[model samples]
Target: MKKDIILAGVGGQGILTIAAILGQAAIKRGWHLKQAEVHGMSQRGGDVQSHLRLSDQPIWSDLIPFGGADMILSVEPMEALRYLPYLGKEGWIIANRTPFENIAVYPDLEKIYGEITRQPNHVLIDADTIAKDVKANRAMNIVVLGAAIKHIGFSVEEISDAIRDIFNRKGEKVVEDNLRALQAGIEAK
Candidate 1:
């Protein structure tokens, strides 16, 4: 089986870190993986995206074709809409309900929320508040990942293991809090 996931956010939002953890988990699960990242002026909060492919077969490219993604994991609402065209009709979207201001005006959150809900497969999480509650607002990406894993065929324990491995040097409490955040996201909806 093959899965294509697109993760999007602005710079410093942990988009690449999220991709790395997912890739590591896929590796631990013994799946062939390929990942590509693009950061458009990421330093100033520009668009940052990662294309991740996990499959039982050998994968050649890290790029995800237009409308070829099975899942879209977005850390910000507007970024989720920006990558909407990449999701096929049957694709699932897991988005954080946070607003990332880029343009002079922010996008309409309620309208975007309504459109995403209409897709039937979309899952929205308040990752920002969740992360803040965990005292790691930066872990919002992991929160989004936790929500996204429900669509993918992975167990929560597997994801927790991956988180442990990824943040092994950050001390036990950090990993534990992240694990809790992940569980909170997974159990949401």
Candidate 2:
């Protein structure tokens, strides 16, 4: 099986962290992977995106063609919409509802959300709020990652384990908080 996913968010929002955790999980499962990332002006709150392709067989390229992704897992709502051309007809968009408001003239939230929710397959999550709820506000990206649990091929255990492994070096409290944040993401409405 092959899966193409687009990870989107602003700089410093931990979009790369999500990619790293997913990479670790895929590695643990012995999957072949290709990833290409664009970390444009992240320090200036510019757009950040990564194209991640994983397969049971070999993956020849890192880039995913337009309209080929299985899902777009995003930590920012606008960033998710920015990649609509890459999203497949049956693709799922799992995105955070909150706006980062980096630009001077951001679009209206209602219209943006209306367009996003109107997509046949979309799940908008307030990952920041959820992370705060779990007392792991810094893990908002992880919370967004958690929201993609069902959409991705990895088992919940696989994801949870990956999180533990990723955060283990950070110490116990960090591990526990991230775990809770992941759970909150999974259980998000």
Candidate 3:
């Protein structure tokens, strides 16, 4: 089977890092993976999107066509709506409820939340609050990633192992904190 995922958010939210971890995890599972990223004005809180494709066969392209993604993992609720058109009818969406004001005019939280939940396949999580509770608010992206892990069909241990391996070079504490943040996010929902 093929899995196509799109991740979107503003800059400094670690969108690229999440994509990297997912790609690495797919690699670890011996799946052919291709990832493409667009970082338009990302440094200034502009839109950032990464496309990831994983399959048992080789992928010829790194891009995902409109409405072709099986899943969309958004670091912010507004951003999730922004990319909603790209999600397929059976797609699953995991989005954080943190409102991002810098990116387009911010919408009413309650209205947006209601609309997002109305979608057939959507999962909303308070990743920002969870991150704050874990004292790692900057790891919001990782938190969303953790929440989406189950839908991606990978074992949490495998993803955690990939995370540990990726951040091991940084330091023990950093790895530990990220793992904890990931676990907290995964368990939150």
**Steric collisions counted per model:** 0, 0, 0
**Worst 10-residue stretch by lDDT in candidate 3?**
38-47
Lowest lDDT 10-residue stretch of candidate 2: 37-46
lDDT of 3 by residue, 9-111 (tens): 8877788888888888888989999898775465676777889999989899779989999998999888888888889989998999988787356778999
> Which pairs in model 3 have colliding backbones?
none
Q: Which residue runs does candidate 2 get wrong by more than 4 Å?
A: 40-43
lDDT of each: 0.84, 0.89, 0.86
Ranking by TM-score: 2, 3, 1
Output the lDDT of residue 23, model 2: 86
Residue-level lDDT of model 2, residues 15-84, one tens digit each, is: 8788888888999999988888874465467888899998989998789999999999999998899999
Q: Which lDDT value does model 3 have at 138? A: 70
Ranking by lDDT: 2, 3, 1
Candidate 2 TM-score, C-alpha based: 0.96
- Once fitted onto the true fold, the runs of candidate 1 whose alpha carbons sit more than 4 angstroms away are 39-43
Q: What does candidate 1's lDDT look like per residue over 49-161, in tens digits?
A: 88999998899877988899999888988788788888978899889888888788776789988877777699988998988887866678888888888688888878888
User: If candidate 1 were superposed on the true structure by all CA atoms, what would the RMSD be?
Assistant: 1.6
